[model samples]
Structure formats: structure tokens, C-alpha cells
Target chain A: MRIAFIIIAIVFVALTIAFTILPMGTIALIPVALAFLFSFFAFFKSKERKRIFSKWLMFFVFVLFLVIVAKDVFVKDKVVTDQKFQLEKQNSQQEAQKELEELEGLK
Target chain B: MKKILTIGVFLSFIRICTGQISPNETLIFDGSYELSGMMTNIAQVTMQTSVMKTTNKSYLHLSAEVATFNKWDSFFKIRDLYESYVDPGTLKPSLYKRNVYEGGYTKTEKYSYNPAGNSIKSESKRKNNPVVKNTVSIQPGAVDVITLIYKLRSANLSGLKAGQSIPYIIVFDEKQLRVNLKMLGKEIVSAGNLGKRECYKLSISANTNKLKGADKNLIWLTTDSKHIPCLIKFSIPVGVGQLSLLKTAGI
Candidate 1:
């Protein structure tokens, strides 16, 4: 039972990390909650010698939870203008205009 | 009276078949992605329309620009542009171009329409690749995706019944793709900054496999005359993508 709890906790922790890095908003909370629940249960069920790792896993999940909250509160979405893209769009328009002028029928 | 009614129905059918075009307008959408049971902002997409005049005639120029947020750029940067020039009166595409810069991959496709022969001359160029040229035949009034979207707004859809679908021929990747836009009735949806709007819910499907799942790609267009696309949801190979109306001009 303890091994199963630890394995599930590990999976949740990995998911939490990946989602947090993906910056997928507050979605990491799902894995964070699962990781906390399983890790807490595993910590209680484990022997004293094995308790250290479970405690660390719970702590990591807590840290990830804080990171997700912080990112949600802080991150601002902005589209940085790419000058090269703009230049290309302008050049494309010019070239298209020239080509359109050369086309046989438009009337 | 019966003759007048028949004429009215016929005109409405023609209007639905051939959509009108607004001279100029712009729409901005906040594109987001759904993953891990949460939706997150992914990019900003802006669609603008204007008139382009040449020595011979005037055309309605449509352009859509997509740029990923600075925060998401590191993971997967996307800077894409799609442009189409269509007849101002009929909304039939005269030329279309797509320039895509997603992550490390870049490609450009240009199609020049020949309405007389009902064919398109296509040119495709990719990064570090030779330009490929081909000619593909198409039915009359076939258009690119951008023009099709605009046409949807201007079309007289009152004659359409629920589950009724209209087929459209789209030019993409130097090939003609059969796309179906199905009416799915109406619903009131929250359209971000646009607030609660009564919309004509519709589903879009294509023969290509790029769009996954049936009924997964949905669009909510406002029922008003402007017919603004308030919210759009599409399923991509990676995941579900959504775009909500953020701002608008001349709607």
C-alpha cells in the first residue's frame, strides 16, 4: 500500500512539474492536490527510515503549487512585434501587387 | 402575393449562396489552448480587411496575423500570416497566400485564381526547398479559408435549418479541400470582452486529417448583422484550441 501511494505520488509530482513549466495556468493544481494527498498518506504509512523521501516529495509539490500561483498572478501575456515578420509581410504585399497587376483578367 | 413570396425566397437563397462583403473591418481574438483541464492563453490573432485597388479593378483584401505570446514563445513560437484578395462584389477569391513561421518550420503558399477556366495556379515554397508550382481545377465561387470565414458573416443564413450544412471548396497546399460548415442552432455564449452574446453555433469539418474529431471544431458567430465570430473552438492534432473575441473595430 505504501509503495502504491508513493508511485502515484511520484506520477502526480512529475505531472505537476510538466504542467507548471508549460505554464498551463492553474491546471497544475489538479496534480498538486493529488500529489499532496498521496504523498501525505505515504509519509504516514512509511517507516521512519523511508519517511524522508516522502516528506521531500510533499515539499516539492508544495513548492510547485506556490510557483503556479505566483505565475498566474505575475505573468502578463504580450505579443512582441517581430520586425522581420512585418518586413516580410510588406514585401509580400508589394510583390503580390506587382503580380496582380500583371494578371490577365480583373475587370 | 405568391409570386412575390417566391421572389423573396429566391433572393434570400441567392444572398445565402453569394455573401456580401463589408468594405473594411478588423477583429482581434485571444487564442487559447486547453490542456490538463485548464485553458491557457496561447496567442493573439488579428483579422483585418481593406480595399486594394489596382489599375484594372478593386479587390477586397483580407489578412489575418497570428503571434504567440512572449511567455509562450520559448516553448513554441508562432508568427503566421494569411492573406486573400477576393472580388468586392462576390467575395470570390482572386489570390491567396499563407506564410507560416511556427517554431523552426517555415513555409509559404501562393495561389492565383483564373476564374475564366475555373482553375488556380499554386506556388509553394518552404525553407531551404525548391518552389513547387501546380494547377488545380475548382468550381466557381470556390475561395480560400479567410474569404470563406468573411462570407459566413455576410451570408443570409435565415433560410438555413438546423443540421443543414453548406459545402465549400477551399484551396490549400496546392490542392482543393472540401469543407463543410454545418448549422448547429443558436446559443448564448460569453465572448470574453464582448460579454454575453446570442450566437449562431456552427461546426466546421474538412476532408483533411489536420482537424481531428467530428463536432470538435465549433464556431459561435453573433446573430447580429455583423455576424462577428465571437468564439471559435477547433481541435488540432496536439490538443483543443479556442479563440475568444478580445476586441473589434467596424463590427
Candidate 2:
């Protein structure tokens, strides 16, 4: 049971870290909760020699939770124009106008 | 007999109304995605209509632009443009053009309609590929995606009963796709920046692989005379995305 708890805690922590890196930091809370629960159980039940590892794992999850919250609250998304795309759009409109003229002649 | 008369009276009282696309009208919407009750904005979409004068005639020019937010560009960039030139009275498309760039892929397509022959001359090009041209036969009233959206807005949908579907043939990617628009009734929905609006809730399904599930895609149009599209929820290959109206002008 102790081994199972450790494995689950590691998996959830890994998922939380990945979500933090991705744009899905808001969803990382699910894995954060699971990691906290398993890490708490593992820390209490482990022997004194192994308790150090569990304590570090718990600390890492807590820091990650704080980071996710900070990022979500502070980050703002903005849109920037691509000059190449804008130029291409201009050329397309010019060509399309010519095509429209030709099509009207056909009609 | 009384039931039939009652139904007729109710339908007449509904006062089916139609709208027209006025020149210089513009609508802007913010597209986002919801995951686990959290909303993440993805893109900004703009739709505008104007009059374009050719050598001999003037046509209705409809254009739409969809661009991903700068922050999301590093992950997946989308810069899409769709333009359609249609007859002002009929809303039948004369020319349709699409220039789309998603991530690293790029493609451009143009379809010119000939009413005399009931056919479309198509030219499509992809990145690092030669342009291909072909002629495809179409029905009398076949329209393109951009024109279809405008036509739907101008359509008198009040006659349709709840759950009734209207099928449309649209030209996209050099093929004619059958898209069904179903009436799902009316409800008050939240329109971003506009607050709550009484809207006509409708569902859309297409006979294409891109649309994942039936009845999953929804569109809400204001029930007022403008009939402006206030909110839209669509299913993408990855997940569901939503577009909420942000602003409008010259309605």
C-alpha cells in the first residue's frame, strides 16, 4: 500500500508539472489535489528513513500549486499582427479584385 | 379542424421576418475554449460587409478574419481569411476565396461561380504544391461558407418548427458539403459585452469528418430585427470551442 501511494503521488506530480508548463495551468489543480492527498498519506505512514523523500515531494507540489495560481492570475493574452501575413492579404485582395472583374465580364 | 386553425394562427402571429446585409456593417467576436469550468481565449474573429464595384456591376463583398491570440501562436497559430462576393439581391455567391494558415501548413482556394452554366471554376493551391484548376457542376443556389453565414442571418427562420432542420449546400475545399441548420427554440443567452439577449438557439451539423458529433454545435442569434449572431459553440477535432460577440457596428 505504501508503494502504491508513492507511485500515484509521482504520477500526479508529473502531470501537474506538465500542465503547469502548458497553457492548461488552470486544469493542473486536479492532479495537484490528488498529489497532495497521496503525498500526505505516504509521508505519515513511511518510516523515518523514507519520510525525508515524502516531505520533499510534498514541498514540490505545494510550490507548483503556488506557481500555477500566480501564472493564471498575472498572465494576459494579447494579439500581434504578422507583417508577412498582412502583406500577403493585401496582394490577395488585389488579385481577387482582378479576378472579380474578369468574372463579371464572363457573367 | 380547430387544431389546424390554431396552428395556422400561431404561425401567422410569429411574424416571420427577414434581414438584409447592410454595407459597412461589422461584427466582432472573441473565440475561447472552456475546460473544467475555466475559459481560455484563443482567437478574435471579425466579420464585415461592404460593396465592391467591378467593371460592369457592383457586388456585395463579405469578409471574415480569424487570428489566434499572440500568446497561443507559439503553440498553434491560425490566420484564416474568407471572402465572398455575392449578388446583393439574391446573396448567391459570384466568387469565394479562402486563404488559411494553421501552424506550419498553408492553403489557398478560389471558386468562381457561373450562373449561366450552373458550375464553379475552382483553383486550389497548397504549400510547396502546384495550383490545380477544375470545373465542378453545382446546383442553382449553391453558396460558399461566408455567404452561407450571411444568408442564414437574412433568412426567415421563424416559420420552422422546433427540431425542424434546413439543409444547405456550401462549397468548401473544392467540394460541396451538405450542412443542416436545425431550430432548437429560443432562450436568453449571455452575449459577451452585450449582456443577456433573447436569442434564437439553433444547432448545426455537417456531413463532414471535421464535425465530430450531432447536435453538439450550436449558434445563438439575437431575436431582434438585426438577428445578429450573439454566441456560437462549435465542436473541433480536439474539443469544443465557443465564440461570443464582443462588439457590433452599423447593425
Candidate 3:
């Protein structure tokens, strides 16, 4: 059980680096969530509860990582989509104005 | 015999380097570009253009892999591909298609031009969205973005003055945009591995809000019958992106 937790923790750190350096988008969230589960096991099921400072530390780190990933997946994505919508709206307005100017030139 | 062999090799080398584009022949351009902002490289861009021999169609493909040097990765990895089937006799596009991917968003569009009706029927499909159908009016000889690049190659610009501007229309993303190309005279510019060459300097301005407060996009085309696009510089929301021709083939 301890070995499994150590392995998951290592995978979690590697995925964090990968997510930071690459445009993996929501794909990065899968590993982050899995790490969170492993951290929970480390905190509760580890045999060396008295000397398990590293397990508790990893648990907190995984929690923080989960928050960041959730914010990116839920909040940042929505903001980007909103900005694109606004840009499209502005473009349509400009197109209409240009058409009006052309009509006036013809008249 | 030695002299003849040397001359033949030299002629072939020239042909390979310049890829002398002719009206009746096809040409291909393969190149890479760099996008930078705030004095830092932000992305690597790859571009390829080829003319299909079987269908006589011209295709341009561009992809950008955004870097994560800023700690946070870019939200988008962009890919844009355009294909146009040109009428060999008229050099005008009869059909056009565009496939675009930016981050998680994707859209595919097909346009059919009807010269008889002076209109174009556009069909676009977005991810998880209903298909969009629209018909837009077009001017005579109006082309799409991809076709416009090739059309300008075959166009006669000898009569254009240094400060003169030519008006053209292009249909893109369901919008018929009026674009003006202003001649900024001719100058010698670097052509990467090809070294320096004389090129026609031109600036593009379009009737759109997206270009507000941005410098007009600049283009340098070779001042020859080939009329290859040697260099292009355009401003993005952040800074600028430059696309330069790196090599040519199949001319």
C-alpha cells in the first residue's frame, strides 16, 4: 500500500510538470484527480501514521493541485469562451457599419 | 562533354532553388515561422502549400505549437488548413474549404462559389454545434483567403504605382471582408536560405474591428513571374508573427 502511494505521488509530480510545460488542456486533469485519490489513501491507510509527515505533506500538495486544475478547467475555460463571444459580437457590428458606409458611398 | 554537364547541373540547381512558377505549372512552398511577443519567442509555426496535380487544387496548411515558456501553457494549439479548386482557364476558385482548430475548439467549413448568381454558399460545422448554412454575396472574381494568395501571383501589377492601392474582397468565417492592398514600392529583402532578392512591398488593410490599433500587415512578394511570398509580418493581440518562405518544390 505504501509503495502504491509512493508511485502515485511520483506520477503526480511528473504530470504537474508536463501540464505546466505543455498545452494538454483538460487531459491533464485525469492524472491530477488520480493523484488526489492516492494522496487520500496515503493519509489514512499508511502503517506509519506517527512518522508519516511526508504522506500528510503530499496530501496537502495534491489538494492544492486539485484546486488549481479545477480553476483552470472550470473558470479559465469559461472566461476564454466568453471573450471569444464578445470578439465575434464586435466583429459583426463592425461589418454592419462597413456595409452601411458602402451603401452611402454608392448613393 | 564536361562543360555541358556542368551547365546542366547549374541550371537544375537554379530551377530547384527558385522553383520558377509558371501559369500552367504547379508550385509548392514548405516553411516554418516563429511567433514572438514582448521580445520572447512564444510559438513555432509550420506552413505547407501544394498544388494537387490530379484535381488542380491548391492547398495551404498552417499549424502553430504554442510554447509554455511563460510558466502557464497557452490555451490553444492552432491549426488552419485551406484548399481551393481553381479553374485552370480562369484561375478563379470554384470550390473552397477551410478546417480550423484552436485549442479545444474546432470548425470545418466548405464554400461553393456560384459565378452565375454572384454568391457563395458556405457550410460550417463546429464541435457539438449544429451545422451553419449561409449564402453570402460576392464581387466578380472575389476569392477566399487561400485563393487570393495564388490569384495575386497571376495578377498584373505593372500598372500599380508605388502608393496605389487595389481593392479586393474575400469571404472568410461567414464574413465578406473588403481588403485593400497598398503598394509600398519595391526593395531587396532577405529570403532566408535563398539570400537577398528584390521584392514588392505591400500592406494589407481590411474592414474589420479586429485590426483596430494594430499596424497594417506587411507582405513581400518576389518581383518576378513566380511572385512567391517571400516574407509576411503581422501583428497579433500580443505582439507579432512573421512567416517567411523557407523552400520551394514541384514548380
Candidate 4:
């Protein structure tokens, strides 16, 4: 039972990490919610040492999820937004220049 | 001089009212296409466009779904929905909404245009992040991506000769972009279930290299007054994607 719990915890953490890195958006919440539910189940089903281990693992997973969410909300999103704005600005200016050239040629 | 000015004003008002499609007219088009790569169908696309009136204002709704199926099960899905409220007289969009679900990720964007200030207030939400708010300046008569499509359909393209281009501005994903559509003359193009019809080809392009593989996007619209899009062909990194008109109604 202890081995199974460990495997499940590891898999859940890996999935959380993968989803966070990818562009899965709010779908990452599924694994996080599952991990929380599993931890709660393990806490009641196991005894003594196993219970303590499950508690610590759940805390670790929760923290990791928070970190991932923070990075996305504070860092990655801003970077992407800025890049998109810059690209659009460049494209608009280029088009304006082309229009000017076309008018000049007509003249 | 005063009499002449009054006559010119009356004529301009008449022109404005008759310039585009009547406010009561509605147009709807339904279509499907296959996206293939390496001689195999990788994804199937279904698209629909509805232009109608809502409480004295014209509204356009566009929805598209792309899905990949494996036998009886579906493996991948992407859904995009766009809604735009346009001013009937000026054909300018007042509000635009975009909701997209790609794979498992979901995003929603809403834009409210303040024509008096020549700016757009955008609210965007991705996944579970808090809504990001921004206000961006815009040019006069600027429209969103979906609205631009309908605007093109209603525009007066009769004066445009072969090789002539029309420039327009579009607000997409919180950024303003300038796009030019170059008329490529008329040709007969296959439009899937709609069959073969004479269409006016137009090339669409932006000024940025970001389009890379998707550069040279082309669309063919029917020559009739309805001006329905018959076929849209564009190249991707892997292969070409074509969306042809399968059915249309209420033009």
C-alpha cells in the first residue's frame, strides 16, 4: 500500500509539472485537484508513519502547484503579452510604410 | 452656395444609408473541410458564420471546430467562437468577443471600442488567471478579426481592379494589425459541396515575417452581391489547409 501511494504521488507530481510547462492552461487544475483528493484519502486509509509521509508529500505537491501557477501568472504571461504587442506594433508600422510607398509611386 | 451645400449633405446621407447591406438582411454560411498532411486526413474542420440584427444593431457570429478522430473516438479538438457587434451605418464594430478552446487550454477575450476616444478596452482571461485589462489606441473604422471578414464581404469592391489592394486594420489578441487584401482577378474555383463557381480571388497578408509559412493566405469570394467566401487556402508549416464552402443560407 505504501509503495502504491508513493507511485501515485510521483505520477501526479510529474503530470502537474508537465501541464504547468505546457500551454494546457486551466486544465492543470485537474491533476492538482486529484493529488489533493488522493492525499486526503491516503491520510485516512494509512496508519502512523504512512500517514505522516502522506501529509508531507501532500504539502510538497501543493507548494509545487502554487509555484507553477505563480510563474505562469506573474512571469510567463507578461512575457508573452509583451512579445505579442511588439510584433503587432512592428507589423502595423510596416504596413503603414508600404501604404506610403504605394501612394508615392502613384504620385 | 447654401443650396448647393444642402444638396450635398442630403446626397451624402442617402449614400450612407444605402452603402452596405440593409440592416434587416441576415446571412448565414455553413461549411466543412479536411486538413491533410502527407496524403492523409489529419483533422476535420467545421465552420459557420451568422450575420444578423440584434436590437437595432448588426451582429456577426463565427464559430469553428477542428477535430481529429481515431476510428470511433476523438483525439484532439479545437473550438473557436467569435462575436462582434457592428454599427450599421458605419460598419464599425462596437464590441467583440473571442472564446477559444485548443486542446485542453481555454481563453476568452472581450473588446469594447470607444470610438469617441479612438481606443479599445480589452479584457482577456486565459486558463485561471485573473482577467488582464488593457486599453489600446486604434484607427478610425478599425475592426476585429471576425468583424473584418464580414466588413470585407459588405465592402464596395466593385471599383477595385485586378491587382488593386485594400488596406484595413484589425484588432486581434489585444494588438492592432494592418492587413492588405490584394485583388487577384476572377477565377473559377471549386467550393466543395457548393460546387464550382466564379470567384474573385484576394490575397491577404500582414507586414510581419511572423506569418512565415502562412504568408500568402488567399480567399475566393463569390462575384454576386452576397459575396460569400467560396474557398480559403493557406499554407502551414506541415502542409496546406483549405476551407471550402459546403452550404450557405439566408444570404
- Give the alpha carbon lDDT tens digit for every residue of B131-249 in model 1: 99988888877788898898888776667789999888877777678999999999999876678999999999999988999899999988876788989999989899899998877
- When 1 and 4 are scored with lDDT, the better candidate is 1
| Model 2 error, position B175 (Å) | 1.9
Residue B76 in model 3: lDDT: 49
**Candidate with more favorable, higher DockQ: 1 or 4:** 1
Ranking by TM-score: 1, 2, 4, 3
Query: For every model shown, what is its TM-score relative to the native structure?
Result: 0.85, 0.85, 0.55, 0.58
Q: How does model 1 fare in lDDT? A: 0.86
Tens-digit per-residue lDDT, B48-131, candidate 2: 998888777778889999998887788999999999988776677888999989998989999989966379999999998999
What is candidate 3's TM-score for chain B alone? 0.73
Model 1, range A38-96, lDDT digits (tens) per residue? 99999999999989999999898899899989998898888998999999999988887
Candidate 3 C-alpha lDDT tens digits along B116-209 = 5378778899988998999888877688877677666655566788989888888878788998888889989877556788999888888876
Residue B16 alpha-carbon offset, candidate 1, angstroms: 9.2
Docking class of 2: acceptable
User: lDDT tens string, model 2, A1-107?
Assistant: 77788899999999999888877747889899899999999998899898998899999999999998998789865568889878987887778789888877774
Cα interface RMSD of each candidate: 2.0, 2.1, 14.4, 16.4
Count backbone clashes in candidate 3.
Answer: 0
Number of backbone collisions per candidate: 0, 0, 0, 0
Better of 1 and 3 by TM-score: 1
**Model 1: CA > 4 A from native:** A1-15, A46-60, A104-107, B1-21
Candidate 3: which docking quality band?
incorrect
- Each prediction's RMSD to truth: 4.2, 6.3, 14.9, 16.6
